[model samples]
Target: MKISCSISFEQGLGERLMFFKRRIEKKTYDKSSKKPVIKSSICNGEQVAGFKDIATGAFEEIMLIKNQDDLVEFKEIYGISEEIEKIY
Candidate 1:
């Protein structure tokens, strides 16, 4: 799963994490029309996997990959990849 993020400064549980934003499209049923429709919106910076939850069917969550320090855990769980560092 590839995501785009710019510089981020935050505090608390998601502090060490850098901020990232991405625009996404979503599908939902319209109550008034009683039909399915696609809606597009922007998902703001959040916990690393936050977008994964929002993206839904657009992607399957393999591992809840995060910052550079998580590389060891990511490697342990998902195995080695040369491009892993690019995520942070």
Candidate 2:
């Protein structure tokens, strides 16, 4: 499954890759750069609908932040254009 999500970089690059499991796991960050590095991976057979924080550079999963208040805030800040398509 490949899910496409619109991520706001704010001050980072675009089209960066990241990994995904049933939920996101650790061990994906670059020590030298001190930023989250994708290393060209998408685990759990699903494209994650999320984004990285420009300041922290951490990849965030949409499913993890599904709270009503947070979702509304995030949608207002980042918009709700990102979509995840399940693979059959």
Candidate 3:
């Protein structure tokens, strides 16, 4: 499943892409001087919602969890935390 989220800032797309590039272990690319692309597939009902950052560009990715265990494991593996912030 591919989830689309709005990009809510006016900044360099490369900087925005770098933010997520450091966070998620995924492939990112720049196409024809357009916004950077973070490509991933949704399996087991998990999806990347969108991302969030204002200065460098920010958005969020949402995922659907079918099992509580999986959610917990994801949080642990991803090290999700309120204090954790992504920067370009």
Cα TM-score per model: 0.26, 0.24, 0.24
Q: Which residues of candidate 1, in runs, are more than 4 Å off?
A: 1-42, 47-58, 85-88
Q: Which residue window of length 10 is worst by lDDT in model 3?
A: 30-39
lDDT of each: 0.35, 0.40, 0.40
Model 2 lDDT tens row, 17-84 = 44442432322323344322122234643333345555665665543333344444444444343432
Give the per-residue lDDT digits (tens) of candidate 3, residues 1-86. 99998764456764333234233443332323323212245543333323343345544454444555444444544444333332
Query: lDDT of candidate 1 vs native?
Result: 0.35
Clashing pairs in 1: 8-19
Q: Which runs in model 2 stand beyond 4 Å of their true positions?
A: 1-45, 64-88
TM-score of model number 2: 0.24
> Candidate 3, after superposition: displacement of residue 9 in Å?
52
Clashing pairs in 2: none
Q: Write model 1 residue lDDT over 1-88, tens digit each, in one string.
A: 9999777667788765544544333323223332211222246322232112223333223334355454344444433333431212
Ranking of predictions according to TM-score: 1, 2, 3
